[model samples]
Target chain A: MLPEALDAYVAAAREVGNPSSLHASGRHARRVVEEARERVAAALGCRPSEVVFTGGGTESDNLAVKGIFWARKSTSLSRTGVVVSAVEHHAVLEAADWLGKHEGAQVTTLPVNAAGKVDPARLGAVLEAYGEEIGVVSVQWANNEVGTVQPIAELAALANRYGVPFHTDAVQAAGQVPVDFAASGVAALTVTGHKLGGPIGVGALLLGRDVAATPLLHGGGHERDVRSGTVDTPGVAAFAVAVEITIKTQQEYAARVAALRDDLVKRVLSVVPDALYNGDPVDRLPGNAHFSFPGCEGDALLMLLDANGVGSSTGSACSAGIAQPSHVLLAMGADDDRARSSLRFTLGHTSTAADVDALIDALPAAVERSRRATAWKTPR
Target chain B: MSGGVDSAVAAARAHEAGHDVTGVHLALARNPQTFRTGARGCCTLEDSRDARRAADVIGIPFYVWDMADQFHDSVVDDFVAEYAAGRTPNPCLRCNEKIKFTAVLDRAVALGFDAVVTGHHARLGADGRLRRSVDNGKDQSYVLAVLTRAQLDRAVFPLGDSTKAQVREEAAVRGLAVADKPDSHDICFIADGDTKGFLAKRLGATPGDVVDARTGERVGTHEGAYAYTVGQRKGLDLRVPAADGRPRYVLSITPKTNTVTVGPREDLLVDEVTASKAIWHGAATPIECDVQLRAHGEVVPAVVTVEGGTLRARLLTPARGVAAGQAIVAYQRDAAGGDAVLGSATITAAARTSVAPEAARA
Candidate 1:
């Protein structure tokens, strides 16, 4: 977290009182929380009343997915359809899966293009077929794995025509791109801290004033009674500060990180000619570079790179710390071999040219050794 | 590392020896449970976490390689098929041959690792010969004998010189959390230690008859012939006993007829054994040596001969309870101390010699 955000957090943490309490200290705590909520609202282009604080990105996604589905389905038993893009984070994918398994939800997973994009026409076709039954449609503003920026406005507009609630997990897009909750034409938008240089365990579900979502937690009627928990006052304060600071400088940060990321991709590709750069080349996130090294296992490559002091990931490490073939890549039409051979390198706000240089210096040997490892045949 | 003290200490020793060490735990289960509800089984989520913790303490990079597909195809499938064919296959031996040596070792070498280090208690001599560990009770040479000479060349056994107790002591001293972890026993994938139950789940129950080998009369019934191993005495559930009032041992299992043959204990004895797919580590025959029939079974003196990729061994002493699919590892007793591993083959058949043994004559 940035120093300014940390200061706000530490200051808020030292004060005593519940935001819900009625005493003097309680009122004081309530004022601090309300002010933080307004700052977050102003930063994200949403109303303070629309911003409902929750634990983080995962929690916000669950609320928007399950809560919206439940509320819509409850009002009309026919609204049993839940549509989501195949490239969504597990938090959203698994939430849709749960509803399908237990709540009689018919989940229609919209496939993405080779670039990992959800075409608006695909959503329109699904809505045209089952618009009345479809309770909600969710496509992430930007993918967490491949960093493909979706045309959220077009998608939300399409869903709006069908009278279906549209939600976006904007956790990865908030500070890296222009995210205006009010202008996005979605009923709900998910944002989190940590990703925007704020503290962990604090985020917001920006629900449209007219959007009806059932409460996931029920106690003391907090956050418009849609989510109930003792407010994380300090985390909220820090998150708002992070939001204010990051939005103010989003363009400059994006440009700088994008430049470094470009340099990394260029140099890495030059050294390994056959390596395929993954995701949407033109519409990718500023700070992300993904690649599929032919004949290399992503996990082995990641370990070799880590040993060389260059930390990277095989896109996603599952619960067992075993790297499964990337679902996003598979959805993007890559073969199983290509999917398992991919690696994701993320350049954060703190990254610099030197960091890119370190990666470039380490890539060739790591890739070569990894390829050799994959080429080994068992003598069975 | 298997979330056990021996592997933890082995990793520690290798790191301390100044080699760039990387700790790896194989995720051999397709759907590993979040935690082990029972004390048995490896490859649980808990085991992965334990391995990660050990890596953290050792200050080395760690990874869990998903070898589940390979393990399932090569080891688990082969085990079931062997049992279905009425042979008592050792999963550990199969695992060592396929997973630890072939799959994992090949991957390690490809990744630029000089060798794949394991915690098995068997020594690789400077002469490039594999020898029994000084700790006789824990020697794993029998299971490891399936590995070819090339696989052995790339394998390192750091814990071979230390006893199990010494390994635990070293682990405690190194502050590895798995210091007190109990040793894994039986078939690791069989979480409940019920071989019959595990096989029944996969192969299903095929009703068969148990026959008295002496009289060739049906004496009992079995759920599946695969459930009984040669030389098994208990759990026969026999309907009738010997007229002399003695217990019957499982003489043989014939999957073709779905019959488990049981008879007097003397009927189980055999002096001649034949094995197929012989893998010679370094030693050749016909040579006089000692042969170990089971994982920890005592070694009996024998003259072993090889021809047509099959090995024939004549035991100097009559052996009992020898089973097909068990590895017969031949070892030459070194004048210095520990016995050196010579070769191994999977026993294909066991039979009584054409002539009566000296013990029977006496």
Candidate 2:
């Protein structure tokens, strides 16, 4: 799968053309970019013009959030605040926080349910009360850690009612679920390449024609001037191919990945009886499983699995090498012990049933060893 | 359970003892931003990962406990307060007494565990008595002396009988990731080994005068008395030198007066010290035993007499520079190759010695 994406990337890299240039070579480059854009739009069910290229997921999120917020606030002094869900990715949440701290922007973070999903009704009430103050309402399409899929359509509908621009970070949900940008009624949507088996360092911010966005990076007038930078032609081409393939095979892939995830959950729980499964069981992502074993540490489990040739994730990969507990878990109301005891196993295009089997086979012994090494004795 | 060889072995021993064991690595750091970009220490992200790896090798359930707030309140706050009061404090002692044995143990009990175990190099006798470990050079009884009876009852120290080398060998044998993990020293919170700097950062320096006891003259200017400990010598830039051309040692720190007193080495020695907040491990009454005033100091012979809530201990031999706020751990010889800890007390005061020419001969 990786080879295929690389092949497309290599072919695109050989061509020399600037999508924005008017020369013959530039026109050729423009064709390649346009073709990729059309493919991505077709997959996401949005107009080709709506797809705006950015550096990556983080940049895309920044552009969508800060862009819309500034644009709305510029129109009216009353629209000076940004409302976002509590569990948003740092790209959205931290940007809002930075704006609040440095740019005099007020931010109201809506709460999430036990499953890490936000309620549209609660959001609507918040909008009714502070709608004039709210410039933009942002919620993630899905949570990266727990894999909880939020009700984006309902949230967008409510935001639309208040004439507030709604943005969703669909970075994790783009290929895993059916994300129709038009049907969702969101002003802006974020999707990244790497999450969908595409090349890294490339993603897009889908902006509706009516949506107004202020450019973050100022340079050459690329990405319709909403995001100014040299276009990553190869990365964009690979991403387009990956998105097209992912969308075509999404249903079958979801079925297979969900089966493996469920199997893993069953096997892990069976071996470690007191394991606490995190996130929404049914409404979660198809290929993600998060569990907290009462006595085991997440890092210990991850290492144990790694030793046996199985790879997994714990908390955010950004803070990869650290032994710190996940803020996401903490924000979801997990106590210190529970938050520390958790591990996340995410499946991708290359994951298979055998991989799940290997994990199950190595689990019991690893858990036993980890428990012994820690000598963690809880009082009866 | 798994990070270091000792903890790994301790977990193995507990499991061998037939108890349902689980490994836990506490995440005491509040934010990853506070961690040194690349450093190793307990509660640091790297150490936690190493610990987790060890737990996995041992096949135990592993967890990270978020004790950031608790750590700040207990260890960090206590350390700052101890320094502010013109005393040197051991943060490891406070962490063991508060977080590890108490908070972690309480949570373990609530989770239906039989006991909380650690790799502390201290022993529990057959009669369930707390004693020094077999390896005298590696004995860690002083830091653990602050544990109460209730805490000791639910605690297990598995590395008590084993040497550091043996623990490493066992970790290698078990294929633990932290088999060769370096032993972490220095204050965990002060990642750069700058205790004085840490104190200064926490407590702003209050300018004070360093005075000579004999001449009654201001010899040097110091940032604060609290910054200087009882025996520190090199950092004091004194303009006046001793008659013998020896460096002046910090004899006393008076936070109330905001003055630091410097004198000869002999002036720092004291024959008697009074300790408050005495904790007797097993016995209800105070007993005479050898006491170690510092973590690495010699165990000098002393007679402990309790009156009300305070303990007055008179050293049979002259001990040097016994500072207030140091722990005086009492130890009695046991049949099992080492001494058993009787109790401990925090030194509240050191009695001034009046020089007597004839009495020194006696």
Question: Which is the leading candidate under lDDT?
Answer: 1
For candidate 1, the docking band is medium
Off by over 4 Å in 2: A317-333, A368-380, B1-227, B231-249, B252-362
List, residue by residue over A272-338, the lDDT tens digit for candidate 1: 8999998889787899999999988889889998988889988677777788899999999999899
Docking class of 2: incorrect
TM-score of 1: 0.95
Alpha-carbon RMSD, each predicted model = 2.3, 8.1
RMSD in angstroms, candidate 2? 8.1
For residue A355, model 2's alpha carbon misses the true position, in angstroms, by 1.8
